[model samples]
Structures are given as structure tokens and as C-alpha cells.
Target: MSTTISRLLVANRGEIAARIIRTCRTLGIETVAVYSDADRDAAFVQLADVSVAIGGEAPADSYLRSDVIVAAATQAGADAVHPGYGFLSENAEFAQSVIDAGLVFVGPRPQTIAAMGSKIEAKRLMADAGVPVLPSAELDGLDDAAVQAAIDGVGYPAMIKASAGGGGRGMRIVSDPSDVLEAVAGARREADAAFGDGTLFAERYVAPSRYVEVQIFGDHDGNVVHFHERECSLQRRHQKVIEEAPSPSLDPTTRTALHEAAVRAGSALGYVNAGTVEFLLAPAVGAGSPEFFFLEVNTRLQVEHPVTEAILGVDLVALQLAVASGGALPDQAAIGAPRGHAIEARLYAEDPAAGFRPSIGELRSFAIGGPAHAAVRVDSGLAGGGVVSRHYDPMVAKVIAHAGSRDGAARQLAGALRQATIDGLVTNRALLVRTLQHPEFLDGRADSAFFERNDPAALGAPLVDGPDVAWYAAAAALAVQAYRRSTDRHTAGVSSGFRTVPTGPQRIALVDPAGHEHRVSYRF
Candidate 1:
């Protein structure tokens, strides 16, 4: 039952929407972009062959409105819908709605999504499929005593997680028995607010572990293959900050075992399309092999898919479209081995000095400098004169670098980030550059707690400081004075900065990215 998608609708925004459009253009598929009020003039909207206004700025009124999105697709004459990564990508009901509307849903079967959507149920299914999983207990509708008992069963230092969602929401780690009830109540409220489902579960917490995941793809013809693994240990609050392929931490045996486990997990679910099987690898003690436990499965393409694509020389979104159209999986041998090392750093609009608070404003100037080569790539949704609204995720771009070795990739990525010119909003670019060059990160020992062990203030400190700041401020003041003089018609003959009566030196104040104020005084 193969059907061609002549016109496809992208049900997402930002860099991902732009990324999908690139693939569609190469494949000669016409694209329809759905936008909110905030994204009416976005890059993706301008790139699409057709555009539709869905709703307001908020996600509830826009991207998450499944009915509205499906109707937009129908109205735009789109035959397929690609839900990029976030919002309703993993929502089974949304997938069903796309299917019911007689449009292709470029993802897994609705049953598979429903089965793996719940952490509790997914863990049970994985355990049944012989994949290693941590001990966990369901806490929905349980009394305080029962909740405590469940926590005791899962052991101390348990994590209370929202069963219905991911992205670090509705998650709280409790080490003390006294905090169990409060943690549960708070997690429930947060989960209800975020996902409309307060169902929760508790799992044993593992510290000093590596966060690794396997990229798997399946087709309708009952075949599943892995694109190796990615190390995502560099994180903040469980959100991935930097990701690299062919984890430097794993030996051959562990790596093979992880890939096999991932394939088995996907096969068990009869999965179709692109998905990731995440795992936590515990540190080995003495001569024993390190043990890996299944985390959760993401039912859509990951944000870090570029790193995988870089190393494998493949297009995951293209493959996703092919599989969605009833195509068969490529031969396992044809997929081949990873060619080189690739690392991706997420560039976000946040003030690292202010505890990573989201920054919003017009992007007065935004440019990421690097050779437009396959070795170094930047996927972004914004440019000069664009607005970073407060209604959406603050990720501005993903900068990726590929080289023959890990050190080479890291150095290249760091250099590219250093050359980027981003103004008008605070970002984590400094922190990303510092982390890429950090000794522990370079040696591949940095874990999920890398930020906890290192001082972010020190890492995120501006590269320019001390006497150098004063020199730059002086230059800027001079440039401003020159510009004003050149533009002022009445002062053309005043000889610039001239005063009939001598007075104090002219003063100008400027603020640096770190919020430090510099006062420059000069006289002509």
C-alpha cells in the first residue's frame, strides 16, 4: 500500500521546521507550513510553498491544536504531516487524528505510541522483552503509606517522574523519607499542568552514570536497524546540552550490547519510523562489565539527530518520510559503520549567569560564522531582525562539527562558536564553548552532573575582560561619535566634539553581556 506524498505539511516551527523543509525541497516535495501569530513571518513560513495561520502565539492555541493542524493540512492540500519533534509529536491521539483525516502520519503506529507513551507501561514492556530496566513503582491513587511503601520498594534516592511525559518536567529526586509525600504532590500538580495527566511512578536513582541512547528506525516491512549510539551526558536539569556520536566512554563489548538491546526493544514494539531508546550506563567496578539500564523511548526524531546524520552521512528526516510512505527498511549492511566523530552543541537564548533564565527580544544581529561545508553546520530558525518570542522554547540553533576524531570535532565546534556574533539576547554560547574545551569533557568522563561538578559562572565568563574591556568600550564610543557627526548636517563644520567653553570629558556608559557596566570618558 505505497502512496506518494506530493504536498506535505510541517506541523512544527523553528529550526526543525526549517530542517524538514530542506529535505522536502531536495526530494522535490512541496511543503505547507503552519504558523502561529508569532511565526507568521518566520523563516520556515517564508520557505514553504504554502502557509496557513493556525491560531495565536501560545502552543495551546497553535501547535498543540491537533484538529487545527489537521484542518490546515487538508486546507493546504497536503497529503502528509510531519510533526518534527516537540509539541504533539508523541501524542497518540494526534497521530490517530492525522490518520483519520486520510493523511500520512510520519511516525510510529498509533498503538505503538500509546504503548510506549507511559513510562510505567514502557518499562514493563521492555522488562518483558528482556531489556534491563530499573526497579519502579506506580503511585497513582495510592495513599501516603502506600506511596512510602512503593518508594521503599524502589529504594532510597528514588526519582518521582511524570508517567505521561518527558523533558525533565514533573521529576523530583528524593533522598529522605520525609520528603516523599511533598515530592509526589508537587510532581502530580506539575504533571497535570504540563501534560494534563498527573499519573506518576518512582524509579531508583543512579548517580555518576553516563546518558547514552541508540537511534533506531523501522519500516512497515518489519525491519528495524540501529544507527549506533550517542553520548548525551553533558546536560543541565536533565536537558541535553551537548551530544556526540560513538560514545567515547563505551568499550566494544558494552557498545555492542547496547545496540542489541535497543534493536530488541524496538522489535518488541513493532516500531515504525524514527525513535530513540535511551539508557543509563553504570560505571564498572573492578573487572566486571558495566551494566546498562533502559531509560525511556522517544517516539519521534530527536533534536540531536544531526550528530547521527553527520557521522553516518544520512538524512533521518528523509528516511522518516520514506518509511511513512510504506517503504521497506534499507539493508542492514548498507547502513554501514560510522565514518567519523560528530558533536552537536545546542545554542539557547538564556542567561547562564542568571540561572539559565530565558531571554526574549529582537535579534538585532545574529550570525554564526563557519565554512558552509559538511564538516561544520549550523541549523537555526532566526536571523537579523527576527524576534525570539517568550511563548516558545528558547533554542536558537544547533551547531554541529564533524571530524575524523573526537578531539578534532570538539576543537572545530569550539572555534566556530567563538566566531559567532549573536546580540540582543543573552545566550549559553559561552558555556557551550567552555564545556567543549573543558579537560574532563575532552577526556570523555563528563557525566549528566558535569554542571554540578564545575562552576557554571566560571565556565560562562565572558572571553573578554579586564583592560581589554576598557579598550573595546573606547573604540565603540569613538565609532558612535563618528557616526553621529557624519549624520548631523548642522554640525558638519563643528570639527566634532568641539566646545566653546572647556568642560569635563564626554562620558558614555555601556553594559557587557555579563551585566557589568563600563564608563568611558574622553576629550578631543
Candidate 2:
């Protein structure tokens, strides 16, 4: 019963694939990368010891082709497959296929994935395992009247959710009973389009709630460990934008209870490798403890895993490799108490002012630098010359900072983002910086609806680089011309900066970011 994986094939692309390859190299394991035509020259592919082209650019033709992936692994002689988050990471059939092909999958058992993949089934399982679950009514063969009765029982302000999918794809909030039928129908349609399942369910919508999740790891020995809690309250479009380790608002007692419940959920699934048990905490009433309800379980590594690693000084991917290789669970004492604070902001190639639409263009200049006094870590898949295409997710990079306290961490990250110079593509960098420095976010009072409550217009105003910015740009352009002239044999002795031709005053036409053009005159 050896769990050793000598050669690992990463079944993903982009930054996550690169992240896993880094851990694999550190662990002395040979790594293989699979890519579609669009990602053939991606950073992750270049970093892999061996790479194989799967198919065309689209996910369906490439990344989502489980059979093709297994074949590629076989050809590359990979002993195991590591499915990073997204794509096929949470797909139970893909995991089972890897197993069926006589290769190990670096995630939970297929049965565990299936059990938690569906919201309806996962809720029942959580409730059975003594975990606090939000009340939900199944919509299997229910008539309109029955559905209304169930909604009345759960009260108004209920959410109509698709039991088969997540990421807010098939979710609708029904405040009026008159809108219940339409909401349910809409949720089902969206669910079918996203996950190919139209099954719908109802749950009471909790507002003014905080999103908290516990990271859990388990081995084959039935031993499970919790990595405390992460406050993921800052969200937009039902997706988390900022995540931090060691929630600033949780008390010691509440933190302990959250960990215990997470452990219970993991133990019930007999989980393995890295997984996350998400929870929603209602606002505290008087002096009473905050009420928490199980949300769902992510059966793979999370994008914000770096925050947890920063607080605990642990490489979660390394731990996943060890556990998958039959290593014993990490000792409880060694897990230790989380230290300091960590914050992560996901930078995406999208315009926050325009309803967060994807921005596709070449990254003319992308530079991110931390202050000389702060600690910052940036994980990115694309480089300065890389193109942000319409074929994939709009995420460009993840900026994370660690400090001695929550405010310190938030401030550090905000400063780092503000100092970044990203041109030729609209991005959410400015918005992220504002969010990190906002009063509510700084005071730990920002909840899941922070963006909805706050005005995007005010928060996402364009950055003003001052009147000197244009002068600097002109100077840089002139410097480049001078260098090019010096490199040319015909003009090697000519100093382009000195205006050797003695022409009239030079007029440089420049276009501002708002599409306005202006002319500047200079003499040499």
C-alpha cells in the first residue's frame, strides 16, 4: 500500500499549474505539464520537466478532456495526476478516471467528491454528521403550492439555489412570494447551463453575514486536522476578491468551535489531501455567540491557500504530496497556532467600472513592486508581453502580503497594489487598492455585500498620475529612440537626443487614457 508518486502530471493550466510544479520540484518529484494550443508557451509549460499538448484552446477540447489527459499521462509515464482547482479539479469522474487508469489522483476519493458535489446531498450529509446546516427544501417533483408552503416555512428573503452548481451561477434571492416561481425557474435554467443539472433547492438567505471557511487535511489513517479559519467576507458578484487568514473578528471560543465543526465534516467524508469546509457566520446577537451554518466543501486546493501557508509557514501543496504518498498525518502539536496575519488580493484583467467585464489586450507594461519596508508575494501566470485572451479566466495575478497585524497586512497589500504599474489593459488593481484601504475593510466591518453597499463609482475612480506623468512618458520614449540610434551603424556617432537635424520645435502627439489627444512642443 505505497502512496509514493514518483512522477506527477499536473492536470491544469496557468498560475495554479505553476504553483503545483514548484512544490513538485521541491519534493524531488518529476513533473509533467499538459497544455492546450493557447497555453502551449505558457509559463507553467516551460517550467515542467516534460510537457504534452492536449488539444485546441477551449477547455472542452483540451483541459476538460479527461480521457485525453489520462492518455497523455500514460505517454509521459506519469505515476499520478494532480488536478489543480477549477477545470477538472472538483470533477468526480475525472478523479475516478485517473484512478481507473492506475494512476493516483492528488485529491479526495471519487465517492467523497460525489457526495459533496451536490448541494442537496451535501446538506443532508452535513446535517447527519452533527454539523449546523442551513434549512433547505428539496424541489423534487414538488408542485407550485407545495413549493410555496416550503418557502413560507423558511420565511421570506430566501434564496433559490441550484443544487448542482455553485459560484452563484444558479442562485436567486426571492424576497417576494410572487417572484418565487420565476426565481426558481431562472435558477434551474442557469444551473442546467452551468452544470448540466437543473435541480433546484431553497434556503433562507442570511444577510449581513460573514464568510468564514476552515482548511482541513486528512490522511488514510482517519486523522484530520483543521488549519483554523479564513475571513473571506470581501466579495463581488458572489465571488471572493480578498481573503485573509486568522479572521480579525472571530473570538477564541468561536474560532475553536469552527475548527471542531470543520473536522467533523472532514471526518464524515473520510477526506484526504487538501479540502476546505466553508461556513457563513450570522451577525452576533447581544453577547451570544455567532451562529454558523455549513455552506459546502471545496474538494481541492483554493486560490487563497497562500494566505494560510503564510500564517502557518507550511507548504500545503507539499503536505498534499506527502499525504498522497502515504505519509502520516501532521502531528497536532506541530500544526501550532497561526501567527501574524496575511491578506491576498486577486488582480484580474477586468474593468471594475464597467460591470467587471473582461479586458483583453497585450500587457504592455506590468510591474509590481513592494515597498522596501514590507513583505509581498505575487503569483502570476503571464508576463509583461503576455496576452490576456478571451479564452480563459480574467485573473492576472494574486498579490499577498503578511504583517504582524490585520491592519498592517491590509495596508501593506494596498500599498503594493497602488505601486503596481499595469498598462495597455484595464484591470481591477485600482479597485483592489481602494478596497484594502477602505474604512470598513480596515476596521474588519466589511461583509460579503461590501461592494454592493458601497458605491462602485466612487471606489473605482481612475488613478491620477499627476501632470508629470506625461513628461516622464515622453522622456522614456526619447531615451528609447536615442538607444536605437546609437545601436545603428549609420547613426552610431549621431546623438538623437541632441536634435542633430536642427528641425523646428518637435511636436509630440500623445493620447491620454480617456481617449483624448494633446500635442506637446519641445526644443533641443
Residue 286: error of model 1 in Å?
1.6
Q: What lDDT is reached at residue 351 by model 1? A: 81
Q: In terms of lDDT, which candidate is strongest?
A: 1
Q: Model 1, 1-524: lDDT tens per residue?
A: 69898999999999999999999999999999999999998998999999999999999999999999999999999999999999989999999999999999999999999988999999999999999999899999899999999999999899999999888999999999999999999999999998899999999998888999999998888899999999999888889999999899898999999999999999999999999999998889998778899999999999999999999999999999999988888887898999989999999998888888999988777777656443578898985447889999999999999999999999999988888888778888999999999999998889878999998777888876778888988998897788787899886877767877668678888887766788888899
Candidate 1 lDDT score relative to the true structure: 0.91
Best by TM-score: 1
Candidate 2 accuracy as TM-score: 0.94
Judge candidate 2 at residue 184 and give its lDDT. Answer: 82
- Each model's TM-score? 0.96, 0.94
Residue-wise C-alpha lDDT for candidate 2, range 143-255, written one tens digit per residue = 98898888878888998888876888999999999898888888888999999999888988899799999999999989999887898988887888999999987888889
Looking at model 1, the pairs that clash are none
